[model samples]
Target: MSTATDDGTREDAPPTPTKKQRRAAGIAEEASGGIKLILVKLIGLGIVDALALYAAFVLVMHEQWLVTVLVVAVAALVNWIYFSRRKLPAKYLTPGVIFLVVFQVFVLIYTGYIAFTNYGTGHNGTKEQAVSSLMASSLQRVEDSPTYGVTVVERANELGLLVTDPDGEAFVGTNEQPLEPATGVEYDGDLAVSAEGWKSLQFADVLARTDEVTALAVPYSEDPNDGAIRTPDGQSGYLYVSTLEYDETAGTMTDLETGVVYSDTGVGAFTAEDGEQLLPGWQITVGFDNFVRAVTDVRLAGPLVYVTLWTFAFALLSVATTFFLGLFLAIVFNDMRMRGRKIYRVLMILPYAIPSFLAALVWAGMMNESFGFINQVLFGGASIPWLTDPWLAKVSILIVNLWLGFPYMFLVCMGALQSIPEDIQEAATVDGAKPWAIFRLIKLPLLLVTVAPLLIASFAFNFNNFNTIYMLTDGGPRDSNAPIPVGFTDILITMVYKVAFTGQTRDYGLASAYSIIIFLIVAVISIIAFRRTKSLEELN
Candidate 1:
């Protein structure tokens, strides 16, 4: 055997490894990847172990800090696992990945939960916000109350000196009737007031060779016209005023400023007991009352139904017309022989380039019944009822939307058309298929597969196109007998805006619920369309 140099060296350090040890090491290395994996594992373990040890030390050192220590320890453990643990997949988290994943997941779930609850701008505040608001109001102590627009102070001396209201309110004490000294008290000095505070001396301090005595204290009643009154303790009275008063007993508050009486019925919101509703401030929930009113109230439902149907029909027709027009334009523009094709394409996309609101408004003005340019040109002396008539209003919305939407489909179709192999079309042509036959049998079917997603997207967009409906006729011609206050051209989105927010009392809870329901409807419809189109197979 050869002896090794001895700086803590062991000559018999097992001579590498036996066959069994070598096999075991190989197995471990394969299971864990390589040296890099082993190092990562060790580092992660070290971090967790160190944090655990620190947490244990904190727990032992400070028993009362259980929640804080445990929270810190758990956070460290999570970081360690997120950084190095191999149980979870890598795609779930990448390097420098966030360790507080639970927090994000919790927030998403909480938001979804709020959609179901009556939680919104108009509804009552959440429990936590309400509690915090109450605590803030209750704990606030007014040091000196604003009474009779003046500040009256009783000094240590028995002198009764009143200061004029610095806020420019009418004053009680003046130069003619200066503050009087109380019977038992004496005025020690001239009245002096500063921005800091009022200052005066006791009568006892002025008397020489007299034992030091505290100043006289005089109590006076506050002015009756003002909101202040004398207290039973005979020293000071509390000026209890609530800018927003909540009568817990009656669950109502008479707004001192607006003179509106708002009543709360537990869940969230304070509504005026009187028929008149308040606006432009905090919204209160009225439970299912808004929904009931929306459904049963004929004034709202009548117009709502008409507008809803028109909205759906418009969306459907818009998608169909835009698709066919776009396909036709794309096919024409796809020909390589067409001169200045790029220019034609750019000109076609001009409508899409313009803001829809501006375009819609401009279209409205041009189609106006009285002074419209189109009416003047066509009817000459006669004018058209573009906005007044219900059918005409619906036609106007569809026409403008179709003009705006087709360009987008045309652009998408052009790109998708280029992707189709030219050989496929040539083969069809060679097999005795005419141009329309080739397009219908080969091109159209293939194009549908590519453009189906965009079709669904376009439909969804048109369904909620509020700007077009709002600017055109505002859902009007005002059908008085309609279920709700609805217009001939009103869509769901536009109707919801007018009924829920435009009214005197904003109904936020119903609005939130309606939005959530609409979202669900759209999502379901899209899913169905995707399944029917079998676009997922193409994507996969």
Candidate 2:
């Protein structure tokens, strides 16, 4: 449509969209959005499926049949849920459930399993593997062993020896399989150069893996009494026999030279009459023994008792000191008359803004006995031995923790105090209550209702505060007299870590037992604390 203005200029009007055209446009837009959503879903599911398939393949190769089945089942369930329009809730929940099962549940169950077994350095394999290891460790070369021409070969990533005897007969063997006659073995001089399906290692390859080539023990025959063929140089092999003979029927290992018989007394190792035990013992279940050892072992009991006590004291004192300091500062700054309150509040929380571990490390450096800022500057070069002395180390840890931890409590208390209504305090004051009475009766109870749970969590966190103790003192002023490596400042968690990782012999089962005990202690304490906090809710 066109209209003529007074100035004789023509004006054109825009056309309006019809109802059918609008509806068609809407439908097309919806279709495009649906297609996009489908593409996204497919891409996400494809990635998940790829990862799941890879994990399943690895599990299958390891012969973990049950775990492989579980993984496959989970992947299939995820696909079914995501592809179905009806399972919207399931699609949302599946990822979280899968992660929970994989990380938390699996680790908990495995730790519990290890806690009841002798699963440490020397007891980490099956009985058969232990027997093989024991035999291999005791192997000695025969007096008149015949040397055979040898060549290193690999098949399916397993190394084997291809040897040609003096009679011109070729044979091949690996650690798992006994020597068997080979057909179609290519020979150069008297050495077996290559086989039909095996890849022969060149001189460069053999030199690069000299240790593996030399340690590769090929069994001479299937008989237990027969010795194995071992190579010192890649070109020559010799027969070596084990000094100890294992009798499977009688479940005993006998020393041929000493005539000492070691019997398996169901203790995961072969023990002789003289109380000597053969190592590389198989893992076995010993229900409650680890737990009993923690409490009953003469060497560990004294340190355990003190460490447990110190752990409790440290947690309790950390919570008390941090809370009081934070609460006091929060109260001071929360006053209406306080000038520049915002700046002060921000300064108070600066410690919390930094990472706790980094703060602990900085404090650790500053608290050093001779070279630290605190000793050299603050104390005027006083050698106080803050970390080296036992009592002072504990105090130093408490001081640093308080400094690092108070800022968090300050922020929490500030938030909680702001949440408290001013009307309640005014009402209390009008009722003839003094300022202290008003706070004790009204503000404190209400604040506690919000912060008690946080305090309990703080206690739990400090109970296992490995970073502070580990970074500050490393639980040292080491107890030289203790049989195990323990210190006066060692808490339960740090003690567990030291026992499991720091020593020559890592006792994982005992550490796991300690971990279970810590869990139970924290659980019981949390339960009681949470229940007690319920009484504060009545003030609301």
Candidate 3:
């Protein structure tokens, strides 16, 4: 073990590491960590790319190229940020920003766009689509056309037809493609047993996709006039031709069967010479008409005024009652002498703990006019129209809302009360000031400082409280004078919902206009309330 080196050092002593060696080791460790990070980012980028590809496919199928491009571009940017080393903060923010743009920003912009157009049940999609739909509706089977056995299939969101020609030749096609001979076709009972790309739809599948199957039309060699294969039962295909023929050069749709001609009126629909219009017109922009109708339509304006006032009153009363009840409960429990305060607080919160929708349904059953618990048992069989009568329904809504909303106010007020300083209250007591005086003059102001913003938020929430009004009353106890199902119990939001969905005339444009107004009103009121709260803070 004892040996001498050339430099006269003992062989048992080890050589120390140099500065270059240490530096090289540190560099290698950092490179290893960087490689791991790159791998994780690459995996994440792959998942994002796959999702973006699927989304782009869907949007492109719907002819929304702009949205598809935006999705792809955003996905690319997300990958880029994660791939780059300098943009660490963006890695965390990209997903949330993408979702916000897709779900919130796009929805708001689309809603605003719809408000300026007649996009409702009867008026939807583009002009060419409307024409095709009109023609599809007026189709009749050709008298001499042969009946072909068929099977329904699906491609993307569209339906396809697998039909056997009279010669027992199988052809597979969709509305967009002409019927072509299909190879490798398996046959059973004169119909297609199987096709390579097409799936044979069962009875249940056909039933579920009845609309799509009914809308499907496969052309005979791309000539629509040359009778095509159509299916009503999704099993038997027939050759049919549109009775209504559209002449592009003349810009007129002629009914070949009736000799009636309809010309485009530049108002989104084709109108006949006799003033009759076709069903399912195309969407078209009508500047300010919907907005004007919201404010000036004699039919809607009258009821809207009453509903607006009622909405205000209802919101104000609900907040007032709930806050007072909750505050009283909080104060009672906050007293140090109170016994079992925690248990009582928990019991009080049970109402708020239950889902509001379920609670509304429960209340609705309990308040039934003839056989409900309140009428049958509590009132000794006296029948009362709790929901059918307008005034009584309004009262019932307030009571139910108070029960549901107070616990939230109670919890907030309790937290605020606990946070208030004990020193100020003790000093007031020592100065011989009464409890009510100290509370009203000093403690109340301090409490308001913490609770005022919440109160405003509560007021806004109640103003558009759709579920309570809808589930209990359905905006009913029907008003004969109103345009749509307006009643004393109906608030503005409920009225808007009724206009959009409840009636035979679903006017989405007007409903969107109403929604925009509601949004503006809420936003302005919130801003004003916050400013007032700030003033109160300044005064204090």
Clashes of each: 22, 0, 0
Instruction: Tell me which residue pairs clash in candidate 3.
Output: none
- Residue 281 error, candidate 1, Å: 12
Candidate number achieving the greatest lDDT relative to the actual structure: 2
Global local distance difference test of model 2: 0.89
The deviation in Å at residue 391 for candidate 2 is: 0.3
lDDT of each: 0.60, 0.89, 0.85
Q: Which digits, one per residue and each the tens of the lDDT, describe model 1 over residues 147-170?
A: 322223333333223333334322
Better of 1 and 3 by lDDT: 3
RMSD values for the candidates in order, in angstroms, are: 14.3, 8.3, 6.8
Query: Ten consecutive residues with minimal summed lDDT in candidate 3?
Result: 219-228
